[model samples]
Target: MGRNTRKRRMPLATKIVAGAAALTVGGGGLVWANFYASAHEDHSGHNRTRSAAAQVATIDCPDVGQKIRDVPDRARGEVDGELATMDSQITNAYQRLATTRRAQAGDAQFVQNSILGPLKDRRKAIIDRIQLEINRAGGKADDNLDELAACQGRPADQMQNGDGQNGDGQMDDGQNQGGDGGDGNGVAGPVADDFVDINDVQPNTRDSRNGLAADGDGGSTGTFTTDCGVNENNLFNSDNLIAAPGVDNGAHHTHDYVGNQDNDAFSSDEDLANADTSCQNQGDKSTYYWPVLRLQDGTQEFDANDQGGGAEGNIGKILKPAEAQIRFVGSRQGDVVAMPKFLRIITGDAKSFTNGDANANTSWSCSGFEDRQVTDKYPLCPDGSQVLRTVNFQSCWDGQNIDSANHRDHMAFVQEDGSCANGFQAVPQLQIRLAYDIPTPTVENGQVQNPYAVDSFPEQLHKPITDHNDFINVMDEDLMNEVVDCINRGEDCQ
Candidate 1:
């Protein structure tokens, strides 16, 4: 058969699903993603620009070799040395290729034949060495490097073209797989090479103070006030916070619990009703949750790989604000009106990690400093400062529904002019400003632990700025009454 006829004669299933990925939900709402993309260079034996070459099909190569600890101590040094050399080689080669692409002057074919081709070969070689190291450490190495090493460290089936999807510098969808960025994985990798070398990160700036301070020296928090303080009872650490309110392990990510510390996947309205609160009033049992913003308290870097899975939906770290301001604007209005109890709400996009950029609602700044902002990756704050994350949520409510199908329909942000958007009805605006004292990793009892790290879901590595939060109001009837009275009267209450 002719080549075109032969291609058309391929398997029916493969032909039906071929292209970039789009998620599908089954009857049970379980996510089913169909991803089909070429995993290797197109080789139609035609001497043309690789970009114009006809595309081919390939299977995904799942990752391997993260079980670095399994490598025996004796083999570790050799393995480390080999991997380090590979890192340097690939990074340097890509650096040059990227420079060529930018200049738009180098012969693309020449660069590919001379530089890119060799770099890809080096990448192939890395798989064997990585597997050897893993096996030497008494761990099993994946039999195939297609998913792990394909595209030279980029995730197996991600969109490559500069469709503005990931920061991966690939031009459109059908170009060289090794786009720019560190190792082409959207990660800067562990500060392995830069450790002890650089003294500061880019866009570093000084911080200001919260206007909500009792002294009122800084930004304004409006009328919102709380008795919740920092402590084990008010603020607890939990790794598995159920995603949906009543479903266990639903979140698949870790979160810091503030206020009602007894919260978990199975926590019910009654459970919260009877639970003791860390709020000073003792009657304010509201529960607040957000992905933990771990501080780098030690020398080691805590990564998404350690305990959390590295899958895309599993969750990664690093969520930041899309803009450069902090806002606390509106709430419901009326006399003697009370918020619907047990209301559930979530703000900020949860898919920021996979989307490759934080939504505008997400914001970040260095602790003690407010002039700078960071996204895409965690900011390496100055030596003694901490990473401060400020995430704001919607304040306006539908005034009738406690929650919606998506849990957010009942709540909304203020209007562009700072007026309540959902309706004239108002409620308290909720926002959380987290302060992280990022410390270097330290050795505890001879075991090294990463101090500045977050706990999220598994499956895909996460950056720090993908910060998320959850809240459930368990306010007493009296306190809710007081809040309603104060807001209706247009008086700020602490």
Candidate 2:
């Protein structure tokens, strides 16, 4: 119950293993007396043999294992064809996950609605036909569907620990010993162990005097927080949803969008300017978005997908930050420059990140219930506080353009010493800080695993690598000017 419910993507369609003939076709149930469920796993741990005889590979999806060739020669193609279709469906899921950074939350129910749903129904239909063909040919169709779905392979222990082997890849001899973990042979095989304990993965332990300029409200004369507004929990409010604004679900992934409701792939500043809002403030009309991270409770994940939370602390089943802190962080005598309309800006690539080093301008920490804030590895929040993802965008603009060729050229991160680079003029600095009420990542065999997960770029996150954010400014002419003036005058407001 503590794992994120994000399912892995398959570049091709996959199918859940059929649970042996329920024979619900007409009425009565017909039991498969040929095979027993427990026999699916051989006591000797030689699954290859058992797997070879099995029709389904895994419970979650039918493994592309051996084809059933025992059927009459004419019927073999039909069975093979059904499996091929399943593969294609699985591929579609993979494409969705790759582009959108998340899988459908319906789980078995989701499987029933989308491509998986049809796949399963078709598979059942095909199996029924196959059984009929066998009966017509005076043969028996030994059912093995129960075994197929029995081992869905979602458990952490089985995933990291192949079959039942220990960290060394060798079958556990009861000692559970872990050495340098690699086989003595110098083959480029998987390391015996690659995961780190949650406590061992502390990426940020800096006490104070951190290099970030936006770390405090030093010169802020006031702070303005938009309302917790509506939470868009359902995936893809628009066709071009998630990241890649104006592109219409271009990313193919899903995210928890906050702030302005008009934000989308094609939303223009004019759209935000005209849209009504849920926030208490009538002036804040900016749109914000990031991947939805969810915690899985062992067998399944219960998230906003099952409920309604298109608002703060609701979408992705995540609690909203106490307040969204908008600030100006940079030099130039605290003078804030008015942000141009329809400014499209992105910080950190959703599909890219570094576990050992932050490949982007990202920050992480925990607070509220937890005592410490992490800057490196995301905090395994302790006690009351939630983990926070803090991103401070480059405030030094090129003076004329709201965006650059890569959407980054116009702005540059302050120098290592926190000063604007030459030739770049300081503007009303924008800082984005999001907090999540997530527990300390689950500890399984020394590695950190989130109860929920995000769709990120890396093949494997090692930890929770789905932290990212997207923003577009839609402030009104007068309101934009006020934010700039407050920052430029170095007035602190809250």
Whole-model lDDT, candidate 2?
0.40
Question: lDDT of all the models against the reference?
Answer: 0.41, 0.40
Q: Write the per-residue lDDT of candidate 2 for residues 1-494, one digit (tens) a residue.
A: 12113232222222221111111111111111111111233444454223213221112344322223345444433444444444333333322221210122113233235433454565565556656665566556647632322112111122221222322222233122121221111101111132222344434444321225532343333333345343533323321222233232233234556667655545555666787654456676666666545442222223222111110111123333444555544353344456677565666544332222233454566654222433324445566666666666665666776654234555665565444576766555566666666665455542223333443321222133335566667777887777666654555543
Can you give the lDDT of residue 200 in candidate 2?
Answer: 47
TM-score of each: 0.49, 0.53
Model number with the top TM-score: 2
How well does candidate 2 match the true structure, expressed as C-alpha RMSD?
17.1
Question: Which lDDT value does model 1 have at 165?
Answer: 15
Cα lDDT tens digits for candidate 1, 52-155? 22221111122222223335545544454444344334324432332233222224354546555666676678768767766876767557653444432232
Candidate 1 yields a Cα-based lDDT of: 0.41
